[model samples]
Target: MTNKKIAVVISSIFIFIMVISCSTSNDNPSETPVIPAVLNTVGLIRNDAGALNDGYVLFAPIGSNTTYLIDKCGKQVKTWASSYKPGQSCYLLSDGSLLRPGNTNNTTFNAGGKGGIIEKIDWNGNVTWSYTISDALQCQHHDVKALPNGNILVIAWESKTNTEAIAQGRNPNLVPTTVWSEQIIEIKPTGTSGGTIVWEWHLWDHLVQDFDASKANFNTVASSSKLININYNASATNQDWIHLNSIDYNASLDQILVSSHSFNEVWIIDHSTTTAQAKSHAGGNSGNGGDLLYRWGNSLAYNTGTTTQLFGQHNAYWIESGFPFENQIMIFNNGNGRTGGNYSTIEIIKPPVSGYNYTQTLPYLPATTSWNYNYGNPNSLYAQNISGAQQLSNGNVLFCNGPAGIFTEINSSGTTVWQYINPVSTSGVLKQGVTAAQNSVFRSTFYPKTYSGFTGHTLISGSTIEDVNLISTSCK
Candidate 1:
């Protein structure tokens, strides 16, 4: 054979081998597309093979009046409009309605998470029910929970004058001019603009303090584990004393979980008690009435331990019945003043429970978390305030870094599988490539495609909410 012919045959053989290799690589499902490391790109950032692909994310930005539902591809599937900005949190109910709180900008309860109204907007954008709890001395704020029986539980701040605070055994020096306490109200929607408070629990009634012996509720602070110590937060001059940021209900247990940002603890109270029984310390299923059945995170709040486990935590709730760590409590442990440095962690703990009451322990139970997740370098997940975590059905965890408006989903092994950044900001929807600023979201929720809420609704995917799109199409 001629030397030229031999050389041409060798070249052809090499080209054919290269083409086959490329085709095989393309067919492999494990291969992930090369996502550009864009500095400030919004929408979907990462969507790997392990991420749950058949679910949508729901979020309401704190600065905007619009709540959104986006698919795994970061495309808008649905949206609900509100007249006022989010008080802080929103949720998509199973009945194709948006349950959200509207920030009425109440001057009386002029503090963070100041929401005065709760609205139930149907799938077609009509306000079917509206209720307001903001008044001179009390205003609903932060989070709300929709119960299985159609009633809504709201967190509100009730104010007390310094004279009233002093009369209640509060330290005169520690009391602000107006001391703000917390309460939970159960509202049954009576009509389009009316709600009847069927049941309520007042924190003011379950207080104990060692500051004043002459006062009626005075007692040894540490021993009164079931009661709140009015003087625990010595440095708190602000009227917003017990800033309860989140609330959750466990139908099976008939209990309520509330996260107190000020005391840095999650407290569970028996909801089986009537309004009359709740005012006293006895006569509930747990025989503890409205008193705390279980409280964890900060042992020092009740003066049981020297150190604390939670720091400015948010979104403390029980894992649903069928999830991986079912019935366990999960918290977004926002490490605001963590010992080493500021960082964040998602922790799940098995509370020591005996029927309706927690097994009485010095500092609660489960000395440490049953499971926890953080970046190898923990600071990567830090969100100083307003964040949340949810346990999905497939054993994966979805969480939001609220202040930065970032969402991440990690598998049981703590490997990040999916991520997205909020495109909506205070001004409006931001352009794709712009740095995400002022786009803080209170929280984000993951709903499976089979969610009952989407049953009859048309969830056609539209373009990204942001003005321009750069990454989602290519990356996905």
Candidate 2:
């Protein structure tokens, strides 16, 4: 699922709720429709018969508020709830639910039973189960992920007590500065006491304020204004350093790999350990910017001049098993460098030394093999952030564009095999999980009342042939 760009002070979940219904796009003057012409690589994709370019892809438009499960031809199989505050994340589950965080027009949402619950719905949009995480407890972010063990994972922020919050860098002067701590939560499955906390990880505990003030490498003005210390809430803190934004599980290793937008590092949480199994973190510590096991890109080495790196957050995934290039890790560097960088593209990297026992420094993304998409204007597609790189069955990369609201299938020579844009209705694409419709859109961000749309989804296999037709889908 895609993550929204929040400045990091407000509870992310609150921001998640806020953006869904934001009419900011109204402020964006409509520009001429730029029909996607073939990039130089389009010719190569035309020849790659394997790229999946069949059927239709549907999405919830940013302001439309309705989830339209459509076909490649733009036929809407279903449309639901013309009311969900339009946001950028949503997911399809095994139980036929469209998962997404939503906002309510009513300020008293929970009492009205119209907002804040992780609602599961049927194809008809009937609520099956709604898990209302206490808003006071969480500032939810861009997406929600379901765990294989029967729970869900959220990129949420936990509020701190007034006193304890102050020590963690909060400015007492700012009344409602909740002192948000970015975290990963594993919600227990049903049949248990509400839900069990399988595991949890917090960012503040492991940070080191090593950003040398003398050499602060920021482009923004040296604001003469007294900055808030929760600046742990600062952009780089959210982009290259600490707050973990995206997560994926390696069920094989019983480990979790998380992408910290602020720290620009990916970590593997070994769940095999029976210890509290919650909140403990290893690897790059926010202190001293020490590399936990291995580190690529940049770190908090301000003294060395190689300060904060990997500008912002995106996808860092392991090569799925059974692929031609198995075992190698693939990451999509969305190019919002923490401080600054040149190109924005997908980079497929291999470990300098590949084996078992993946460590922090295992796969160093090549400074070169990385691919960038320059949409003509020397500096175009200004907001091309957040991309997911998948090693497709056809050996192509199914690249999702978070800002431009498009997904493209590209071949090795950096060519676009096939492409689809998010309808003005749908804006960003996040961590896509399981897609059914051929040339389908898989979203990891699932919320309640999501079953509003979703009639029958078509299934496409390798961008070449039509595969299975799922009658009715369900989630556990």
lDDT of 1 by residue, 407-449 (tens): 9999999888888999999999988778899999989999998
lDDT at residue 433 of model 2 (Cα atoms):
24
| Candidate lDDT (C-alpha), each | 0.88, 0.44
Give per-model CA RMSD: 5.3, 16.2
Colliding residue pairs in candidate 1: none
What would you estimate as the lDDT of candidate 2?
0.44
lDDT value, residue 351 of candidate 1: 94
Worst 10 residues of 2 by lDDT: 467-476
Superposed Cα deviation of residue 317, candidate 1 (Å):
0.8
Off by over 4 Å in 2: 1-50, 54-58, 72-83, 86-88, 103-116, 161-178, 191-194, 208-243, 280-296, 301-309, 337-343, 351-381, 384-389, 426-476
